[model samples]
Target: MYDQLVNLISTLGFPIAVSIYSLVSLSTKLDELIKSVQEVKEDISAVIKYQKEK
Candidate 1:
């Protein structure tokens, strides 16, 4: 019974750790993507404003 408990804890622990790591990595990537998108939006707005002056 003790061996089974240890095995279960070890197995569950790895996946939970991996899941948390993945979530953190994904969150970081999403923040970078959002910043890039915002930069693109600003660039497009600038272009539009310049064209209107013509």
Candidate 2:
């Protein structure tokens, strides 16, 4: 019974911890991607404006 409990704890606990870490890392990366996209949008807008002026 003790060994069974220990095994269960290790199996469930490690995966839960890893899942939480991965989610946090993914969220941070997604935020960075969004920021990069916004910057690209601004650059495109500037290019369009310059072309219109020309």
Candidate 3:
């Protein structure tokens, strides 16, 4: 019984740890992507405004 408990914890622990790590990493990457997209949007808006001035 003790051995089975240990095995179950070990089996479950690794995937949980990996999932947490992946979520954190993806969250950081998603923030960066959102910032980049916002910057691109601002640049496009600037270009459009400049063309409209002509």
Candidate 4:
């Protein structure tokens, strides 16, 4: 019983930790991607406005 309990804890712990870490990392990366996309949108709008003026 003790060995089974230990084996169960070990098996469950690492994957859960890795899954949580991956989610946090993905959230950070997604935020960066969103910011970059917003910047690109602004740049495109500026170019369009400039072309219209010319």
Candidate 5:
């Protein structure tokens, strides 16, 4: 019974750890993507304003 419990826990722990790591990585990538898109939007707005001034 003890060995079965240990085996069960070990098996579950690895997948759980991997899933958490994947989620964190995905979240970081999405945040970076959002920041990059926002930067591009701001740059475009500046160009449009500059053209209008000219």
Candidate 6:
């Protein structure tokens, strides 16, 4: 019974750890994407201003 419990815990722990890691990585990637989009918006605004000046 003790061995079985240990095996079960080991199996479950790996997937739980993987899930937590995946969520953290996904959150970081989403933050990067948002920052990139904000940069693009700024670039577009600059282009619009330049066109208006011309």
Question: What's the count of clashing pairs in each model shown?
Answer: 0, 0, 0, 0, 0, 0
TM-score of candidate 3 on Cα atoms, chains taken together = 0.77
Alpha-carbon lDDT, every model: 0.85, 0.85, 0.85, 0.85, 0.85, 0.85
Cα displacement (Å) at residue 11, model 5: 6.6
lDDT of 5 by residue, 3-52 (tens): 86467558788677568668989999999999999999999999999999
| Candidate 6 per-residue lDDT over residues 3-52, each given as its tens digit | 86467558788677568668988999999999999999999999999999
Q: Best-fitting candidate, measured by TM-score? A: 3
Q: Stretches of candidate 2 above 4 Å error?
A: 1-12
- On residues 1-54, what C-alpha lDDT tens digit does candidate 4 reach at each position? 668646755888867756866898999999999999999999999999999999
Model 1, span 1-54: residue lDDT tens:
668646755878867756866898999999999999999999999999999999
Give candidate 1 misplaced runs (Cα > 4 Å).
1-12
Shift of residue 14 alpha carbon in model 3, Å: 0.4
Per-residue lDDT of 1-54 in model 3, one digit per residue for the tens? 668646755888867756866898999999999999999999999999999999
In Å, residue 8's CA in model 1 sits off its true spot by: 13
Q: What lDDT score is found at residue 3 in candidate 3?
A: 80
Model 3 clashing residue pairs (backbone): none
Candidate 2 residue-wise lDDT, 1-54, digit = tens: 668656756878967756766898999999999999999999999999999999
Each candidate: RMSD to true structure?
A: 7.0, 7.0, 6.9, 7.0, 6.7, 6.9
The parts of candidate 3 lying over 4 Å away from their true place are 1-12
Worst 10 residues of 3 by lDDT: 1-10
